[model samples]
Target: MNNVEITRAGLPDISRIVEIENNLFPDPWNEQAFRDVLFYYSNTFFTLKSDGDIVGFITAGIEDTSEVLYGHIMNLAVVPEYRKMGLGGRLMQRMEYEFIVSGAEGSQLEVRVSNGDAISFYKKLGYSQVMVIGGYYNNGEDAVLMMKWF
Candidate 1:
């Protein structure tokens, strides 16, 4: 992890972020989605770079309700070669810290029910499955709604 850095995402990183998104998910987010996150929630959007090349990213937003302010992790991805190196965990910790700084009481995210690896990862981060969203994805895959209290 020497020389690896996590920095706020900028407009220029969109193309590479989308490229990584397209490669990882069956229904990946488009360029405009990444743009919207950078435009609207830049405070919680971040990119991980190694040797000056973007290798991973996370997009999150803070949502306030009557009872609680929650941090929503909308998207996260790391280049295939960068997996299993703790880069993803680093990105997650960064976002969680930002959430705490922003006065959020907890964080929430959705994961494909069949994605055992992702679910396990989130669980390792202290997130627990709260519910299942039926037909959550465009392909009708169910999503497990997970939450972690701050």
Candidate 2:
């Protein structure tokens, strides 16, 4: 099996990451959004590469927008061809380590409520459902608010 390389998002890697983003999400981040990430954010974006190809990625940030600080996972996507492998978990474990490096002691994210497989995956990784968002996705799909403490 090929080894996966995980690192922070870098300058020359935006195009392939965008390709995966577009193919994975209906409301993908646009060009400016991506540029903002690559140019402006340093600690929030991380990518996983396999055989020098961008296969999966995870985006997270400090949840300072709320009253208290927390690590918040914004996005986690693995290309369909690469699913069923442990790449997603690996990417998440790396992101969590980075979040703790930045002084965050806990993390939170929302998962689509209907995605039982994803929910199981997160739970297996020690995440617990804390609540539910009524209309979390663009299509009004519900989402489960899950949190993990470091």
Best by TM-score: 1
Each prediction's whole-model lDDT (CA): 0.96, 0.84
- Please list the residue runs of candidate 1 whose C-alpha ends up more than 4 Å from where it truly belongs after superposition: none
- After superposition on all CA atoms, what RMSD does each candidate show versus the true structure? 0.7, 1.8
| Best candidate, lDDT | 1
Give each model a TM-score. 0.98, 0.89
lDDT tens per residue, model 2, 58-137: 87778675565678887888998888888899988888887888778788999889889889999999999999999988
- lDDT (Cα, tens digit) per residue for candidate 1, span 32-120: 98898899999999999998999999999999997999999999998888899999999999999999999999999999999999999
Clashing pairs in 1: none
How well does candidate 1 score on lDDT at residue 1?
A: 49
- Candidate 2 has an lDDT of 0.84
